[model samples]
Target: MPKLEPEIADEAPCSAEFTAYDEEHLVTYLRLLDAETDGADWREVARIVLRLDPAVDPDGARRCWESHLKRAKWMSGYGYRYFLKKPRGS
Candidate 1:
């Protein structure tokens, strides 16, 4: 697994196009997807996957969680097409 960053943006980038940030955090998006599929608690996901402590900053943690998960779902549904279109070994 990739190293989890302790600091995260409060909101992920929301764009019609897949972003460099999206590519950089692809592992995180996948982990978020897996955690959701596994019925993991958001707070626990925040702690374990996102490296956030909900007990310390519930609102921030939730905001980051929701935004990232939304982006993750977008990747699963649509953004993957953009990835496929990228030239190999860019």
Candidate 2:
């Protein structure tokens, strides 16, 4: 799995435009969704998948997961349209 920057996870100001970073981290978003579906604990996901040490900064880790997960949901629901609208072979 591609590792996400801790800063991006911690303070994701989800942009309206689909960025290269978003494209790069697409798998991470998918994993987040799968974890949610499987009822996996956020704390565990943060530690294992997201590589966040919740014990060191519980609030920050939670915020990271929540924001990233929210962005992932938004991508699935609405942001994908941006991708579809792009010309092929960009």
Candidate 3:
């Protein structure tokens, strides 16, 4: 796991929809998702996150969540990326 700077982390603008876990947490999650192991119950993860924020639309949140997991630096040799447009009416 890697410690990411705030700029490319969950602190980024909301449009990016980036979700970040701390280094230690990231490691454990990925280990549970390891190939040798049975797959994690991602639906539960999805359900929890969607419920965590009432503002989140399930479909959109799920997509953002999937994107975050793919290369959120939680998996071995992965990297974090943050990008988003400034919000409208700002």
- The candidate scoring highest on TM-score is 1
Question: Of 1 and 3, which scores higher on lDDT?
Answer: 1
- The lowest-lDDT stretch of 10 consecutive residues in candidate 2 is 1-10
Instruction: Give all candidate RMSDs, comma-separated.
Output: 2.3, 2.9, 10.6
After TM-score superposition, the amount by which residue 58's alpha carbon in candidate 3 deviates from its true location, in angstroms, is 1.7
Residue range 1-90, candidate 3, lDDT tens digits: 333222122221233333434333344335324522455454555444322232455555555445445543334343223222324343
Clashing residue pairs for model 2:
none
- By descending TM-score, how would the candidates be arranged? 1, 2, 3
Candidate that scores best on lDDT: 1
Clash count of each predicted structure: 0, 0, 0
Encode model 1's per-residue lDDT on 1-60: one tens digit a residue: 123553467788899898877887788899999999999999999888788899999999
C-alpha lDDT values of all predictions: 0.86, 0.78, 0.38
TM-score to native of every candidate shown: 0.89, 0.81, 0.35
* Model 1 misplaced regions, further than 4 Å: 1-7
Encode model 2's per-residue lDDT on 24-78: one tens digit a residue. 6777788888999999999998887678899999999999899879888988998
Model 3 RMSD in Å is: 10.6
TM-score of 1: 0.89
